[model samples]
Target: MIRLMQHADIHSVFNIEQQVQSHPWSLKQFAEAVDSYQCTVIEQQGQLVGFCILQPVLDEANLLLMAVAPDQQGNGLGYQLLEHSIEQLPNQPVQIFLEVRESNTAAIRLYEKAGFHQIDVRKNYYPNPDGTREHAVIMVKACSDDFAALFSSP
Candidate 1:
């Protein structure tokens, strides 16, 4: 089940974040996102398994952060969270944007499967644990009249 994130879920969300991210968002960041953005958490067997954060502005939306527990990887939870996040936008955004680490092919494939295409790349956009920086692949999906239909296919 995917639902709006609550204050109590921050710690569980943060745990997944730490497990999946090289440089994870701080607990305070999760708290602020739950309070300020459209955040959603996915549960399985009544336990939090994944979460996504989106920020909508006018006709556009940004997928700020998303993560699934390492143990839960390879499941369709991330895709479900992404699709639901778009569907729940306050006013169906004309476009959606997100940035992913260049090395994160799994996430890139998932975004592409959801109809997002690369638009640009930001150099040294993400810090690495090895004292280096990683590039971020910027992607966007234009929401046309048939945007919702994109996800209807198997």
Candidate 2:
């Protein structure tokens, strides 16, 4: 089951973020998402599987952060969480945008399967573990007039 994040899940979410990514969002960042934007988490048998953070600005929505437990990759949980986020957008002709590490093929594939297209690239947009920066692929998708079509039973 997927649901909105709660105050108690912050610690677990943070731990997952740290373990799965070289550069993870801090507690403060997650806190801000929980307090400001619409953040959702996916749970299976009560275990956290994945989560996505979304920020709505005008007619567009920004996907800020998304992470899946390392052990849960290739299980389609990321797609579910992402689709859920898209489902939550208001019913209007909105555009969705997100950035993925240029080297993250799995993420790029998932985003492309979900209807997002690579719009541009951002140079040195993400921090690397070796104290360097890496480029990111900027992707966007134009939604139908009714956002619900994106989430129809599939």
Candidate 3:
């Protein structure tokens, strides 16, 4: 089941973030996002499987964070979470944007398959624990008539 994130889901979500992200969002950071952004979680058999965080402004929306438990990766949960979040946008957004770590090939493929295309790059954006830095690829998707149809059909 997918539902709005509640305070109680923070622990699980934070754990997944830590497991999947090299620079995980701290629990406090998650708290702030939960307080001000649109957050949702997907549960399977009472276990928190995945979650997505988004920020919408006017006709544009930004997907701030998305994660799936490490054990749950490759099962299509991330794609489902992303599409579900898009469907839950406060208003029908004409565009959605997000940045992905240049090294995260799986996520890049997922976003591309969802219709987002790389538009630009941010230099040395993500800090690595090993003192290295990674660039971020900015991706965008135009959610016009054909894109909106993704939600209405079936």
Note the Cα lDDT for every prediction shown. 0.91, 0.88, 0.91
What are the models' TM-scores? 0.92, 0.90, 0.91
lDDT of 3 by residue, 38-99 (tens): 99999989999999999997778999999888889999989998999999877878899999
Candidate 1, 13-60: lDDT as tens digits = 988988888788999999999888999999999999999999988778
lDDT (Cα, 0-100) at 125 in candidate 3: 96
C-alpha-based local distance difference test score of model 2 = 0.88
Q: Over 4 Å off in model 2, which ranges?
A: 90-93, 147-154
How does residue 40 of candidate 1 score in lDDT? 94
* Residue-by-residue lDDT tens digits, candidate 2, 34-101: 98888999998899878899888876889888999999989999999999888976544368899999
Colliding pairs, model 1: none
Question: How many pairs collide in each candidate, listed in order?
Answer: 0, 0, 0
Worst 10 residues of 3 by lDDT: 144-153
Which one is best on TM-score? 1
Full candidate order by lDDT, most accurate first: 1, 3, 2
